[model samples]
Each structure stands twice: as C-alpha cells, then as structure tokens.
Target chain A: MSALLEVEGLVKHYHVRGGGGLFGAPVVLKAVDGVSFAIPAGRTLGLVGESGCGKSTTARLVLGTLARDDGQVMFDGEPVGSVRDARWRSQRRAMQMVYQDPLSALDRRLTVGKQVMEPALVHGLGAAAERHEKALSIMDAVGLSSRFFDRYPHELSGGQRQRVVLARALILSPKLLVCDEPISALDVSIQAQVINLLVDLQEKFSLTYLFISHDLKVVRQVAHEVAVMYLGRVVERGDPEALFHAPAHPYTQALVGAIPTPRTRGRARAALQGDPPSPINTPPGCSFHPRCPRAEARCRSEAPLLRPLDDGRFAACHFPVLSTPAREAA
Target chain B: MTVPLIELKDLTVDFPVGGNWVRALHGVSLTIRRGEALGLVGESGSGKSVTWLAATKLLPAKARIDGEVLLDGKPIQGLTRDQMAGVRGKRVALIFQDPTSSLNPVHRVGTQIAESVRLHRGFDAAAARAEAKRLLDRVHIPSAARRLDDYPHELSGGTNQRVMIAMALAGEPDLLVADEPTTALDVTIQAQILDLLAEMRRETGMALVLISHDLGIVADITDRVAVMYAGRIVEEAPVDALFDDPRHPYTQGLLAALPDVAGPRRRLTAIPGQVPNPAALPPGCAFAPRCPAAISGCVTAIPSLDAVAADRRTACFRAGHATPWEIAA
Candidate 1:
C-alpha cells in the first residue's frame, strides 16, 4: 500500500540568546534535525524518546502545525509546501492532533458535546443538528456515554476527558492522527483503557497514526514500526517485535534494557549514565556519545549516519549490538 | 530479633470534611524492617501515601490519626511533640515527587544539603559543608563540590533529584519515605534516579518505603509490596509472588492491564471503571465494582486482611476464602 503520510529531511531549529563565546551571538538549538519517516495507510510509526529529543517537534512538523526549517511533506501523493495555501485548510480536515494533557487542551467553559462537534462546525461539514448527531456518534465510538455530553471538562475523569479529546479529533473524520504522549498523564488501568480504545479505533476507522510517546511498552504494543530518537535525530528504526528483542544501536539497547520489566529479573541492567545533553549544546560527533557506555575515540570524532544493516533494520551506531542470536546470547 | 524499624498497627486517618469525618485510611498495618525496601502501589487516593504521612506525623493538624505508631516497639502516638519532632527529622526523612518545589530556589543546592546536615547531624558550618559535599558525591553526582554552589534551577531534573537524595541522606535517617519520587522525570532520567536510589540503599542500609503507582518500577527494587485500594491494603506479598501469582482480583486486574514491552503483543484487558470516590465509596469492598471476581457478599461487607499463602495476605473474600466482616441489615 502507498504511504498516506511521508516526511523527509525535516528540520526545526530555534534561536536563543547567549551561549556564544565572547560575542552575544544567538545559539541555534536544533530541535529536529534531518528526520525522515513514512506511515503507510492504516499503520502507526511509534516515535520513542525522552524529553528534549525532538519527537514532539517532529510530530508538529509532520502535522504542519509548526513550520519546518527544512523538509518535504507529502500526503496522499500531494506535496504540502506551506500551511498558508488555501488547499491546506481543506487538507487539514483529513488530519488531526491529540495532545498530551486532555484537561488543559479543553476549554472548561465548553461542554463535551459542543467541543466534539466544534470541529464539524468549523469545517462547515454539516448543519447544527447534523453536527450534534456526529458528535454523539463519535463520543459513543470513544466509549463516552451520552450522559457526558453536557458535562464540563472538570466533571469527567482523566480517561473520560481523553475520550472526549479523541471524540473531538475523530469527529473531523481525519485519516491521520498525531497522538503526542496521549496517555502519559493517566493512571495504569486508565492508560490501558485508552490504549485499547486507540487500537479498536484504528481497526474501525482504518487510521494512520504517528504515535509520539516516551512509553516504550505501549509503543511496542500499538505501533507496527518503531523509531528511537536521540537529541533531534532518529538513531534506530525497525519493527518493534524483533527490534526490541535485539536492539541494533547501543542507545536503543540501553533504552530497551533500562525499561523496568519483570522478564529480566536476574540480569543486571547498566542504565544509561546521564540525561540527554541540552539540544542547544549537542555533542560534536554522535550526540549520545557522552552518555553511551561503549563510546570510543572514533565515536567522539565521526558520527555514524543511520544506515541499513544485514538484519533488515537501521541504526546510527558504529559499534552496534549484534542482531544475531548466537552473538547476543553470549 | 528486635522490633521492626517502624510499624503501623491498625492505623486509620480521617479528616473532618464538612463536619463529618471522611476517612483516608482504613486500618492499615505494616512493618518496615531495618535496611528493607518496601513498595506501596496504588492509584491516587488509595491511602498508600497517607499511611506514611500519618506514621511520620506529617499529615495536617486536623487529620485525626487513630491507632499505634511504633518506633523501636514503643508507641510513638503517645510521644511528646519535641520527642516526635526529633524522631521525625533525625531518623525518618521524606522526599517528595517534585524536588524543585521541595527545594528552595534561591538557596544554592549545596547550602540546602549543608543545612539539612547541620540540622540532623548537629555539625558546624565548615563540617556541614564538607559532609554535604560527601553526601552529594555518595549520590554519584559528578564534581559534587562544583555543583553544590549551583541553585536548584541550574540543575537538571535528574541532578536535582540526586541533590534531594543527598539531602535526604544528610539526615542519616533509618527509614526514608519517597513519594512518587521519579514520576515527574523522563524515562531515561528516571532510570538514572532509580539506579541511584538502589545504590544508596545498599550503601546506607536505610529502610526505604517507595510509594509509587508504577508496578514495574516497584517490582524492580522492592523486596516486598503492598497493594492498596480506596483506603485500605488490598494485598501484601513478596514482590515475586505478588507479580507472579497475584491472588486478589484487583491485583490480578492491575497486572492484566499492564502492557509488556518484551513479551508478545496482546489486547490489554483494562479494568472496566475508574477508581471509586473515597468520599462515597461503595459498601463492603471498595474495589468490588472493579473486581472481576467480586461476589454478592462483597457488595455489603468489608473484607479484613487475612493470611493466604505463606508470606502473603489479601483482604479479599475470594482470595483467602476467609469470612468478611459481619454487618447489620
């Protein structure tokens, strides 16, 4: 199947005052640098990374909410140059974004029904009565009962508020959904509820998702393909099932190993040393070298470009974890 | 052979809300041995945090704490204010989730640590400063002396957390209560903090009460775990048994709901509803509505914690097959 959304060479840099030696020249923080990915129709591309790793920036760039410094975006074979184009307005009807905090994202003044129906009304897709019907249907699809239609944002539970958010996004009948840390604010059981809902909604709506989250477990469960980002760059990309088992990049290995799972009970996990360095002062060669355990003089001087390996996966690491089972077990 | 480091016997806490006593904890009993790590797992309003806050007398003035709090087998509930205060700060230190808020933004982190050291250790300024640097170094903060002069804002979340741990250590507390300590941090940063906590516990031999909602995280470090619902302990077991063969339906439900990163992909079986409002909890079991194995008796009668398998206790009628509390019609 043809890819529904395609992004190539996406870059977004923010200029901030200070950090320039002697002169007060601005420091350009590369929020997203040279990122590329494609999501096939009815598929999900999970972007997993910690804070300041540019996953959210990449998501916004993919959705065209934030202007990209340099990139190309193609939706259904049509190039999207700028959001200013009149055609982009109509194109936005096929795309939507679900933010992390459902409560803050919503207006307390508006009722759930009106909030869900606002997208349909804004697009001028139907009359007031038709919009009402669509909102009810969408709310029902997201597991929100009609009783919540007139309820304020505060009256609803965290999971219920998120369902309302999903209902609002789905009301637009968007083909592509960019969900950024959508369930991170929720509790465990409630997070599972939202995860199951997302899965069911995908199967029912045949939706394409660019799921951006730091939750590796949820990402592995919901995403067909996973991309591990480090300091504004994609370090590894591959299928979740195999990739998680035998992570190719040392960074990916650290990430996978660092995850607190009951399966690896007796094994000693050498956690990644420190937090990701500030994006503004990203390291000279590989940005992850400062925290990587296997860093060498070569890693300090030359950055390894993300390239394919014999294992049918890609990693931006010179000394990668061998994918072969024999080598990995030893 | 001696008494546990701390113990809570039939503890209950109630706050006067609208002239009526609204219960926060319903008869919680737990023991923390010296150098042992205990995990308290529950959602918000589950009384896991309250159990510690009440034990430490950190709850608000109006919170009515009933039952016995033991320190070295002596009932501390009857202790005088000055005695309890000394026992609280010098022996049992508390760390919160947001260290930034707990820390003074204006003061240098070094000064904060030194202050804690001086207060707990009764050290002079120069000695306190030296001890502060040593504590920082013990927490694995690189260049501890240099980072001491930096303000809380100057440090990363991970680094700020290390400082918090250092300050908590300055007390040389016998038992440290950490409430959702790593929840606010990023995953990789959280891993670093968790590693530091584990290493520090090994070095200090201090009892650690880790209050968190993350089951995987709790399972990773704690030797034993207590699962709480509404305002009571639903189950208590060794960490391995709790994860492997959870008996309580609520515990089983929680495990089934988790998404496994390294395992096969399966549809998550989420519990049907949200946690009940503590103010208007249903009669009998607070978790009956959410429990998959709830029975008719579970609707009206509360279940008391009963011993189940060896080293395990569950407050469920189904798990232990023990009779629940008798009630009037």
Candidate 2:
C-alpha cells in the first residue's frame, strides 16, 4: 500500500534573545531538526518521547498549523508547499487533529452537537438537516448519547467531552488523524474506553493515525509501528512489538525499561539520569549523549545517522545493542 | 499490633454543593503500621485524597468530617486548629502532585525549605539554612547548596519535586503522605522520584501513605494496596495478592483494562461506564452499575469489607466464589 503521509527533513527553529546585551545574537532553538518518517495508509505510527522532544511540533508541521523552517511534507502523493494554497485548503478536509485537552479544544458557549457539526458546515459538504444527521450518527459512533447534543461542555464529564471531540474530528470523515496525547487527561477506566474506541474506529474506517503520546502502554496498544524521538530527532523506528521487546538503541532501551509494570516488582533497571538538555543549546554530536549510559568518546565527536538494521528496524546509535556478529566483526 | 502509627476508623467527609451535601468519603477505615508503605489506588473523586485530607484536618471549614483519627494512639479528630497545626508538619508531612504550585513561587526554594525547618524543628536561622542544604543533599539534588538559592521557576519539574521532598523532609516527620507525587513527571523522572521516596522511607523508617491512580506504580512501591471505587475501598490486600488474584470486580476490571507492554496485542476489557457521581450515588453498592459480576442483591445492599484471607479484605457480594479470572477463563 502507498504511504498516506511522508515527511522528509522537517526542521523548525525558534529565535530568542540571548544574554549578551542589546546587540547580542539570538539563540536558535531547534524544536524539530531533520526528522523524517512515513505512515502507511490505514496504519498508525506511534511517536513516543519526553515532554520537550518535539513530537507535538512535528504534528503541527504535518497539519500546517505551524510553518516549518525547512522540509517537505507529501500528503496523498502531493507535496504541500504552502498552507494558503487552494490545494492545501482542500487537502485539510482529508486530515483532522484531536488535542490533549477536550475542554480547551471545545467552546463552552456552543452546544456539543453544534460543535461537531461545525466542520461539515465550514467545509460546505451538506445542508443544515444533512449536517445535523451526520453529527448525530458520528456522536452515536463515539458513544455519546443524543441527550448530550444540546448540553454545554461544562455539563458533560471529561470522558463525555472527549467523545464529543472525537465526534467532531471524525465528522469530517478525515482519512488521517493526528491525535496528540488524546487520553492523557482521562482516568484509567475512561482512558481504556477511549483507547478501545480509537481502535474500533480505526478498524471500521480504515484510518491512518500519527499518534503522539508519552504513555508507552497506550502507544504499544494502538501502534503498528513505533518511533522513538529524542531532542527533535527520530532515534529509532520499528514494529512496536519488536521495538519494545528488544530495543536496539540505548535510549529506547532505557525508555522501555523505565515503564512501571505491575508484573515486575523490586526489579532494578538502569534509569536515564538528569533532565533533557536545553533545546536552545543542543549538545554536540548526538543530542542524547549527555544522558546515554553507554556514551563513548566517539559519540562525542561524530553524530550517528539513522541506519536500517538486518531486521528492518532503524536506529541512530554508534554501538546499538543486539547487533549482528557480522556487522560487529567488520 | 503495638498500636498502629496512624489509624483511621470509619471516617466520612461531606461537602455542601448547591443545597444538598455530597458524601465524598463513605466511612473509610485504614491502618498504617510504623515504616509500612500503604498504597491507596483509585480513580478521580474516589476519596483517596479526601481520606487523608480529612484525617489531617486539612479540608476546608465547610467540610463536615465524622469518625475517629488516631495518631500514636492519641485521638486527633477533636483537636483544635492550633493543636492540629502542631500535628501537620511536625508529625505528618503531606506532599502533593504538583510541586511547582505547592512551592511558593516568589521565594527561593532554600528559603522555603529553611522556613519549614525553622517552624517544625525550632532551629535558628543559620541552623535552618544548614539543615535545608542537608535535606536537599538527602534528596539527591546536584549541587544542593547552589540549588537552594534558585527560585522554583529556575528548577525543572523533577528538581522542584525534589525541593518539595526536601521541605517535607525538613520536619523529619514519622509519617509522610504523598498524593500522586510523580503523576506530573516524565516516566524516567518518575522512576527517579519513586526511587528517592523508597530510599527515604528506608533511611527514616517513616510510614508512607502513597495515593495514586496508577496500579503499576502502586505495585512497584507499596507493601499493601487498597482499591477504592466510588467513595469506598472495594478491596484491600498485600500488593502481590492484589495483582495476582483480585477479588473485587472493579479491581479486576482495572487490572485487565491496562495495556500490557510485554503481552500480546488484545482488546482491552474497558469498564462499561464512568465513575458514579459522588453527589447522587445510587443506593447499595455504588459500583453495581459498572460491575460485571454484580448480582441482584448487590443493587439493594451495600457490601461491607469482609476478611477473605489472612490479610486480604474484599467488599463484594461474591468475594469467596470464583472471581472474574475464573469466569474469564
């Protein structure tokens, strides 16, 4: 199957005033630097990273909400150069995004039903009666009752509000959905409900998803493939089951080991130390060298490029774990 | 058992909303032995936090608390405000989830720590500053003395949480209550904080009451665990037993709902409905509507917590029968 979305060499930087003086140079913070990935049609690509790891920035760039400093984004075999282009406007109808906070994403003044139907109205897809019917059907699919149609956002619970958000996003019948921490704000039981809904919706609609989240468990459940990001770069990418079970990169190993599992109690594992270094002054060579447990002198001078392994996985590490003997012998 | 360090007997808290009172806690009873780590696991509005807040007399004046709270075998429920203040920092220290908001933003983190030391330990200004540095060092903050002078904003969330731990440690209290202490932290940072808390408990032999919604976290840290649903704890057992064979339907559902990292991909057994509203809880067992194993009798009568084994207690109508595990198999 052809890829639904392809991002190449995506870069976004922010300039801020330095501490020198009035004539001081501005510091360039590379929020997303040289990141590239692709999501096949009807599949999910999970992006897992820490808080400042630029996963959200990549989402914004893909959605054209934030202008990229440099890169090419190909959607449906068409290169998107500018957001203002007529093609970009029409392409947006095939892409929709769900945010982390449902309340903030929704307007309190508008009723839940109207909010869900607004997308259809904006795209001028149908008349008022048709839009209303579409909204009700979508809401029903997301497990929201018709009674919630006239209720304000505050009247609904957190789970109900999120269903409304999902209903709104799905109302557009977008082929690609960019969900950013969609269930992080929910309770455990409710989080499971939403995750199950996303899975069922994906199967029913054959949707493509670029799921960005910090929760490893939820990501493992929904993602066909996973990408581990560190300081605005994809350090590793592979099948979720393979990547999680036998992580190649040291960073990926640490992340997989750090998740608190109920089965393992009092089992000790090496944890990555210290907070991520400031994005404003990313370290030389590998940006993750400061916290990498197996950093060598070579890692400090030469940056490691992401290379494919024999198992069809990619990792950017000078000495990746579990390498084949032939490569090590070389 | 040598008079438990802290014991809460049938504690209930009610808050007025609109015209009627909402029962936030429906007679919660728990006991923490000296140096024991008891995990309280529950969803939002499940009374895990309220149980501690009411026990410590930290709730707002509008809240009406009933039942008994004993600290060191002494009644703490009837204590006056002045007397309760003495019990707060000196005997029991409470740490919240968000350390950034809990710490005073304007003051240097050192000054905040020093103030707590001075208030609880009766130390002089110079002594308090020295003790603050020591406490920061104890929590593994790098360059403890230098970080003491930095404001809250200057530190990362993990570091700010360390400062909160430092302040909580300033009192050298016998019991530490940490409510979702690592919820806002990154997974790696969360591991660091959990390790620090475990180390502190080991060193000080201080009893810990860890309240969190994450079952995995609770299993990793606590010796015993309590599963709370609605406004009451449905099950209580040693952490291993609770994870291995959960008796209550809610507890079983919660464990089954979690997506496993090591296991094969499968559909999650999500609980059907949301948590019941505290203000208008249904009669009898509040969890009946969502309980897969609920019976007709469960809808008319509340199940009291009954001992199922040596140290396990479950509040289910069919606790002794084959549980959800057997049913699923």
Residue A313, candidate 1: Cα error in Å is 1.3
DockQ of 1: 0.53
Which residue pairs overlap in candidate 1's backbone?
Answer: B284-B301
Model 1: residues with Cα > 4 Å off, grouped in runs: A19-24, A324-330, B320-329
User: What is the overall TM-score of model 2 with all chains considered together?
Assistant: 0.97
**lDDT tens digits, residue span B1-329, model 2:** 49999999999999999978989999998999999999999999999999999999989999999999999899986788998888888889999999999999999999999999999989999999999999999999999999989999989999999999989888888999999999999998998999899999999999899999999899888999999988798999999999988888889889888886766677788888889889879888999888768789999999999899999999999776656633553
**Which pairs of residues collide in model 2?**
none
Residue B183 displacement (Å), model 1: 1.2
TM-score of each candidate structure, all chains considered together: 0.96, 0.97
lDDT of 1 by residue, A290-313 (tens): 988789999998988999978788
- Residue A11 alpha-carbon offset, candidate 1, angstroms: 0.5
Candidate that scores best on lDDT: 2
Per-residue lDDT tens digits for candidate 1, residues B1-329, read 78798989999999999999999899999989999999999988899999998998889999999999888888887778888878875889889999898899999999999999888889999999999999999989999889999999888988898899999989889988999999889877788888888888998899999999999889888899999999899999999998887888888878878887766677888888999877899989998887767789999899999888778999988984321211100
Report the lDDT tens digits of candidate 2 across residue range A164-253: 999998988999999999999999999989999999999988899999999989999999999999989999999987788888998888
> In candidate 2, residue A130 scores what lDDT?
93
DockQ of each: 0.53, 0.55
TM-score of 1: 0.96
